[model samples]
Target: MVRNEQRKLTATYLNGVGMAVLGVGGFAPVVSMTLSGPTSSIVPVLVFGCILASSGLHLLARQTLGGLEE
Candidate 1:
């Protein structure tokens, strides 16, 4: 049980880190570039899509890990 808990915690931590990295990588550049010049309309759309996709991936990982624990 302790081992299982540790594994779950590790997975959750990794997921959070991945989400943070993805969020920053996806949006930071667009925000910086937009301030310098006209931003492409698609840039925001793509960044938002990346955020949604990353969130979905994180949820999926959690669900899969939960299933493994069961």
Candidate 2:
């Protein structure tokens, strides 16, 4: 049971990292495009990307604290 819990925790931690990476990846293109010119249409995508990154970071922080407590 202890080993199983550890495995689950590891999985959750990795998932949070992966989500954060994906969020940054999603934003990269939008940032590049914006550097060149106006990006009126991609505003929603940009917002989504920011939200995803913040949420992922939040998840990661929570998991980290939980792990440290354990």
Report lDDT per candidate: 0.72, 0.66
lDDT of 1: 0.72
Q: Model 1: per-residue lDDT, tens digit, 18-63?
A: 5875768577857777789756777777777777777776876687
Best by TM-score: 1
Off by over 4 Å in 2: 1-39
TM-score of 1: 0.56
Each prediction's TM-score versus the true structure: 0.56, 0.42
Please give the clash total of every predicted structure, in order.
0, 0
Q: Tell me the TM-score of model 2.
A: 0.42
lDDT string, candidate 2, 1-70, tens digits: 6755775677677677766666666666567667887557866676677667767766765665464434
Q: 24 in model 2: Cα distance from truth in Å?
A: 14
